[model samples]
Target: MNTTEKVQTCLDFIDQRLENQAEQTIRIAELIIEDIKNLTAGYHQAMRNGNLKEHSELVRQTQLNWVNQLHDIILEQSNRDLSGQVIQALQKFVSNLNQTQMQHLHFELPSPVAREYDAQYQYLSQEEIELLMGQQRLFPDNNDSMH
Candidate 1:
């Protein structure tokens, strides 16, 4: 394979890995939701039985477990952010290479990455915008930075 094809293969691998990470995160979130429901039920049962100690313990466990899960999800997202930056840079490099080597090289690597980035900016979903808006509300003092 030539340089463009090699880079395209690498990019495809990274994209697949990113997609896997996202799916894992979603699975974690679903698990967390189930845990929350079970924890809530346990708390209610302990309260009905007047087991204050058990109720307190359940509360503590719930808090700690959810916090840990949240941390794990955040770390996963951070990894994706770094990977995304690498992908973005690579896409730019590929675009530049195509420009400078068109005459010398003969290869076509269709730029899905470029369109993916553009699509994000051009057509963000309402839910996504609301999520960002919620974050903004959480950090009202923070000045907005480039996403």
Candidate 2:
């Protein structure tokens, strides 16, 4: 498929996934938050116990387990949301292009739409330039212009 078609397909798949998985993503996030909170409380209780070293070690292990669980949940949810279609599309696109052509290709940002009251036509006062100098001197003074 051509680049434009591939991009559109990926975008359409993403839109569908977002629509379907919005609720599930929010639910996963809530569950993860609750799990982390419970883990933190357990760790705090372990810290306060008589068997400091052993309890701390156990808590540390438990924290690692919780982290891994959280990671798995996020990965699973993301995979479900994306469904791997975008990755497949991009792979196909890359496989179709030649090495030299791929190397030379670059994306350019679209130019902003012109406004009737754009700042380019408005003159900055000397004080404004001085104040802006501390941040960024966007427009150089006419006196500083190289003629």
For every model shown, what is its TM-score relative to the native structure?
A: 0.64, 0.30
Whose lDDT is greatest here? 1
Q: Score candidate 2 by lDDT.
A: 0.67
Give a tens-digit lDDT track for model 1, residues 41-120: 88778878988797788778877988998898898899899999999999999999888877787654355654565544
Which window of 10 residues has the lowest lDDT sum in candidate 1?
A: 114-123
Error of 2 at 56 (Å): 2.6
Angstrom error of the Cα, residue 127, model 1: value is 66
Each candidate: how many clashes?
0, 0
Q: What is the C-alpha lDDT profile of model 2 across 1-147, one tens digit per residue?
A: 987677768767776765666676577668767866876777677667756677667667766876886687678677865666666666666656656586898954333432344545556667988888855556666776775
- Candidate 1 matches the true fold with a TM-score of 0.64
